[model samples]
Target chain A: MPLFLRGVALPFNKGQAPDADVLAVSATGPVYIPLAKEEADAPTLCVEENSTVAAGQVLCHVDRLPVFSTIAGKFIGTTMVNHPLYGSLLCAVIKPTRSKRVETLPPVEEPDTDTIIEAAAQACIYDELDGIPLADKLRLWRMAENDQAALRSILVADATENDIYGSSAWCILKEQAQEALYGLQMAARALRFSRYHITTMLPRNRRRALKRLIGRENVFTTGDEYPVTVYDDSRDDVFCIGIQACAALSAALQQGQKHTHTILTVAGDGVPASRNVRVPFGMDLEEVLQACGADPEATVILGDAMTGVPCQNTHFPLLPGITTVLVMQSHAVRTPQPCIGCGRCATVCHAGLLPYEIVRRLENMHYERLRYLSTTSCDGCGACSYVCPAGRDVATQVLNANETRGTIFLNWGGVENE
Target chain B: MNNITAPHIRTEAASRHLTRDVLLTTLPLCIFSAVTYGVRPVLIVLFSILSAIVSECVCCLFRRQSMQVIRDGSAAVTGALIGLVMSPMVDYWVPMLGAAFAIIVVKAPFGGYGRNVFNPAAAGIAVLSYCFPQRMFTYPIASSMNPLPTGMSVGDEVVTSLSLAAQLRADATPSITRMQLILGDFAGPIGATATLLLVACAVYLICRGTISCWTVVPYFATCALVAWLFPAAGVSRMYGVLAQVCAGYVLFTGVFLINDTVTTPRFWFARLLYGVSAGVLVMLLQRIGRVECGCCFAILLLNSIAPIMDRWSWYVWRYVTRFLRIRQEVKAHE
Candidate 1:
């Protein structure tokens, strides 16, 4: 049996927004503001680059994230109401004052060492050294050393005041005092490597676009302004119908748009300054990694974390719906080895259907579950793909599901409310 | 100190992904079926697969769920398995119905694919036995042999072979050669002919890492052993093990049915358990129940208990290892 399952559950129908009406926040483009002082779900990715957004665009993706854009240009600014748990945090209304151009904000690498250290300190907390054993921690605190792992720990402590015990930090063990000093130094160096200011993206015609993407009935418009459209391909339709669908990735790209939001993650042991960068569409992937101080010889670019769309070029266009171009220093981990049939692929499926069963169905051509299993419901989160010990390309199964869906939907196209 | 902590390396044969491998392994059987039953039977089997595919697909639609993966090869495999056993002209609906039940209820509901605990073919046959027993058991038609009876009672002793027919008519056993039976020149189900062919396919399955030979060999051996030892509790021990091995579709069931992954044990020992028990059951059922079609029962019973047998084997192995270790420690002290 596979380890993961494409888990399935009936959609929570009550108060659940229709599939067509919901608008999700793109971190690169949308800024999530709040409505009247209530704790909200995450804000919608409303307002395109130059277009002014209105107040009624419903900002949300399925069940995750808050709704409400903060900019009141042509639309109402999103805000949070009262909440018992995050009562104080609800009243926070952050304005979208940052300019869209790349040259507007100061570069992250240009920040001073003290400011970097201070920012790290605010985000991280250090552990007290009194309780640690001498044999374990003695090598770290005693020296000004150049060991990368020890240096990393010291910098982590100086920046965030945390202890690095059993982790990848042990890879660079060396002289003691130097390790601590080097750790702090490395943290400051890492902090100085950020290339640009990261921001959430909001489509210009948020409500109209959302309505078009989700369809008008799917969008549940409460008292708040929702970015929506009616879904018939129209200029007034806020949604951008994807030009071409990549079955491998579950998301469709927004057509006729110059830039779109994509997931960004920096990986690789050789990269000392790895960070997440949400780059614009058509931006070179290699350039983003280079900006984050990535070592190319030791890198392997994975298009999506779930299913890596590997390209030799670092400068592949940043396509919308492609999660991240993950660069792993250890490329030896991925190999087309045999699956042990452990069923790990079946365990992590959010769809509630076992992956092994799905695979078996695919193999047997059972077509029963294959036709009715709702291949469209899959979000391709890759939880099932990640836990596989054999490291099979589980997302490929999603692709298979897509291919199978084409035939089934066509065959049964006239059956009912397809 | 077994050093069995983590990173256990396996051959990595994917259960669900092994469809191509399995098809490769079972290819020879398909060839044999085509050759023995000719184009008509093969087409019937194909139609059966198409029917299974259609039936399961319809079920998925009724459930309002997508059963898209059902078209890959599972429904086809189920159809082929049923096709191999059908009489070729035995109403296309029968095998299709059987395949549908096997995939949806037995295979899909239990989590489809690797999650099924029974051999899909075995389960389908079992259900088919209950639903359309006559259709499932009616003998196949052959060109080399004479035509079948126009109408006969379901349980009547209608000989499947012309030689058997002649012998029964003449009140004496006819001269049916062992070589002919082994080579599958005689009339039988679409899947029954080419006994050697099924064996060849079985060998490929074992070699390609898609099958476990341990279960198949022992399963045949045990059946042969029991058949030779107990030929009806004092009835003349006329037929021997080799005779029984080559008789009817025993070889077909041994190679294909007994080795179904989901129905048999994953562990080698549990497989032996399944085989031995099935062998005993087949003989017992054949002798006591006086049923000619004992292979279906034997296989289905074993399929039902395969997971249990696996658990039992695991339990026994665990205890046996612990017991031996205790004995070794006592000897060291002494």
Candidate 2:
């Protein structure tokens, strides 16, 4: 095993190893799908209120990207909901009706590069892990490869599941290994990449099972650290995609289906046992928690425990790209304290940035020195805050410094003078 | 609902837990000192702790801070450290005044607890040593068992003697056995004399990760190197190394004051350099300086320059990496 100099060895929460079967969770009430994707232009609504709409029908358009609905129902008036990525987004509320009508794109049997890209765009397949549309990522990769002929691209299916409490990627890879690998191979062949690999943090038995499906040489097992999959596009020639995205792509191209459901890992102290469930888009978060045997009154977070965003309103509808739901007791969260300068924060930082020093400089308003500290390298993994004895929010301080500087120091694979 | 940041979970050891661990490690040393000096050291330590708490409480109230700041137990640690470094023959007022000074002058004004740039205990002991050099350097015989209520008067001829630090400054070979040195049977500061117990405490703190070995190991190694290269007038090289390590506040400061989280450098490389330079400074002060509290002064001096050292170390790392990268590119082209 290669030694990772940074990152903390967080304790894996007990009973977090979800079962291989993905339980299907349907909406018990009206589902709300956000109209706008994160960082995209404001979407213009196309459907009217109370209009009969089928599942997999486009309801709005943000720039050239289309937003699809997963529920076959009537389009009630739009309501404001707290979006997981973009705060306070206008969502189209759809009341479920007794219609079985659904719309899907034509399956491409012999998909080339353009056909796959067009299929991805039509199916509304977004890489939830990378927070980018699949079609755009494909186009960008093709453009880069074409620009530099010597730069060989590698497609990496990132199944590392770097979070301490979630196993959505692991469960998906275990149950649908063939589909995930086939999706990766299809993308690599279309993009004309040199090779493709699947990286996971699974144990020996699970990894061996995956190795059996895809040849053993194609799988790479990384260290089970909190943040082993930080992607740097400027420096790396590798094109990374989440494992669930690959599975979605395969479903879109092979089964002639739209990307509608997401695999979510529901696990925390509030639940009796952790389970991986296939939650359809626009499902209520409260309904998903109740179905997973979690208390509705408990504090609900919409991602993994380390980097998850806490849900302010449990009534908020589930959105795509949200992989984990951490339902923790409200009392389990402790109040932050002042820094004691133990240096444990610096020791556990995966980016090797001095979090305490950054905090000190920020407090003193020493903005000039922060650039030299390389605050932009911080990936906000929360490892520093996890290991801090003082309970100080050192990770947030470093991230805020990154924002204040407003400059990302990209490593372009060359030496730069200080 | 609590809308906290990410990392909803945290490690178990908080600042209070770390302070409790440090206090627990000092218990053995305190007990050993009590047994050696017949309750005099115990009274001094308790009084010092009491005064430090009272002083911090007053400072907090005056500054309009919350009373919860006192619950961290850092004040008591500083007090215990001050008491440990003092001569057991001194009156209760000595330790009481030192603890008050440590908390009020060195700690609270700079912002209590984690924000203090200089270590309160070291600064307190250094101030006391400067004010009362005659009373501070004098030590009663080890295991004297004289628990007299009144403080020992200056120029009293009842078994009072020069401490090992003073003897070394006067250029005389210490008339002590290796066993006595190891077991702390010689006349020195109350808690600092127990070389064996202090070593065990250092090991425990290092194991618990409450203290860094990067600071402690390099400190002792540099001191040993200096002592080996230049032995005292009458002692052999090996004897000088052992005597210098076991004498005065060398081991005590290495285990406690220099390893203090707030005053020391944050990065490991800077800490390594701090330890090495502190060792050299301590040795130089012991050989040439007039004061007997050489370790305390050495720690204070290093604490002042710690931030600069941290910044310099970063620059050095950057330059070295850039140089190596350029060399690599040149080799690749060739």
Candidate 3:
């Protein structure tokens, strides 16, 4: 493949308060915690309806993975709730009580690899972006130690915020650099990888703070490009975990805390000011919007502008792995016109695939030709759609081709192909 | 509330905006043509634009497409291109005929706008040149042309001039000075002349990102290379290259036709190859073809091979890399 620089530099619009201190929003009302993991089979519920449960109490289990409650309250009857990434899921609602009932795993001092892995499993820690349970990921990396793969494995803490209006990851790295790096080092030690790096898109001065915390060489900076952090490097041996997940892992091992609270960047034009806010999982979207002083009439997106899921209403609960909550006014939808063949889409495609050509083949149902064009190489960054003069969803069309072919292509390799 | 897909935001430059930019870039050429060849060329351009819009509307009605299709302004650009390629001395109806053929035959029949395989403007100009060779090739002397309103048809009082391409084909040294050719003081097509203005417009378009420099640079380089390697009789190699580049619709074709987004290859390497091949073909056609200018034919031919070029260029790169890798493995083993 031609080694052209792929990915577009997205404009930063973190609104008026990108550098503002993070606000902590406690759940004032009932929080609905989804029982099943995103895209996974339904988990078995272990709690009874109307029973009192302490915070960090185990509520459900998907095989070996445990799902914990984020609030100490009465366990209400289960109900179907709309999940931002996953569709409607059965959730157990917990109304916060004044009682300070809490449950947490015992903290381990200078924990070894087995102790860290057990603590991660008990704490229900997950990689914030990939939605994969961290304990299982550790097991897989540990297994890979015996494999004779030529590429050396490395651990990476991805602090690069790919969202156009996201600053949560950056804020986490800025405030919790010590804990994040410590967590990364712990994971690397557990995986038997000597090299670990932290990647961020922060400006030089801010990056200097991170570089100071974890020696200058350990912190690598990338441009403010969308999907830059997501691009799979030529060597596929690198294991990536979100910066927030690193912080959570650190908290779980050091403070004996549960991975419950998530830091999210609440931004867009509809809010009075954009700020990073830490809210517990299962909090209502309405409460988050109100905490951010957002306009209720504006459209609420669960993620950033590009590749975000638009919420139909504010009734849905905030789910894990959500880095941004954009409250912006709805723009007038333009009627899509015929493709003028401007090639603007091709210019912004980071995968080096001609999106317009793939779109043409898709329109003609040329499935074999689409394969020849490496349709699966598309990571669906949505840059092609953003730059298309014709308002065509070129990225979505390639994604549809992938769906039709039953291929689960990620960056370079697919689950089926493997 | 709009339930749009992932990208809720879009860039400001839509298809209409691009078309407007293109039209804006051609304004300097139009103004220069009006000053040199009088108001007749401007009138031809306006008439051609009107004819194209009308033809597009008719085609839309017949094809049951929305009237909003014309709002993209592609037909206007096509019409302007068709008029610019015609001689300033042709009858007013000649441009109208060319515009109609461009829209109805070349553009709309292939599902309109971006779907057309061949560039409508180049195809239209080619058809006009084929059917009306006398009107298309003949040009009035720029110095003798009336500045004010005159008869639409070629008047007997005006003196005619031979184009530089025809002179080169006839194996005669150009009577015009090098400065005159650079300044476009001699007779040629309406907009293809004004060599300095065309160069300025090309630069502006490239800087504004309305056209790709990948295609434009390689095309001119190849044309200059070919012309220098085989200079015309009685002319120096450098002058031959300059004359070939500035005269006979060469610069105009490079600026507008070959760099067209719809007909050209999308990949950079394919686009580079397309430009070089187009330059070579235009030179060959100018040397032996019956027409005074062969740019339109070359563009049409290049347009047909663009998809194949896009596919093969990728395969070639892949094979070359694979070959290099295998050779490196052998070297390391040895």
Most TM-score-accurate candidate: 3
TM-score of each: 0.44, 0.88, 0.91
Best-performing candidate as measured by lDDT: 3
Give the lDDT of residue B192 in candidate 1.
62
Residues A1-418 of candidate 3 have per-residue lDDT tens digits of 2355666667777754557789999999999988754435556678888899999999887676677789899888777887657778877889998867889888889887788888888888878887777888887777355544313567889888867788888888768888998888888777777777888778778878677777987887766666674423433366788888888889999999999888989888899888999998889989989988998789888777898878777887887678888888978777777777767677777767788888887787676677677777788889998888888887788798877653424434665557
What lDDT tens digits, residue by residue, belong to model 2 across residues B127-245? 99899887777788886556434453323644777888787778898899888989899998878899999999999988998888888999999999998988888888887788888
Candidate 1 residue-wise lDDT at A164: 10
Worst 10 residues of 2 chain A by lDDT: A406-415
* Candidate with the larger lDDT of 1 and 3: 3
Candidate 1's residue-wise lDDT over B1-334, tens digit each?
1211111112233444455665555556656655544455656667678877886677677666678556346667776787677664466667777787777777767655545667778777766766775565556434544333323222233344432222222335435566765667665566666667777787877776556766777777887788677543322354345445655556767777776654566555667777788777865654454234457777777767766676567458546655876776566445
Candidate 1 CAPRI category: incorrect
DockQ of 1: 0.03
Q: What is the DockQ of each candidate?
A: 0.03, 0.57, 0.58
Every candidate's lDDT: 0.46, 0.81, 0.82
lDDT of 2 by residue, A169-271 (tens): 8888878888888788877766777678888878788789889888886788877667774432222356788888888888889988898888888988888
Clashes of each: 126, 0, 0
Q: Each candidate's fnat, in order? A: 0.00, 0.72, 0.64
Report the error of model 1 at residue B207, Å.
1.1
TM-score of 3: 0.91
Docking quality band of candidate 2, CAPRI definitions: medium
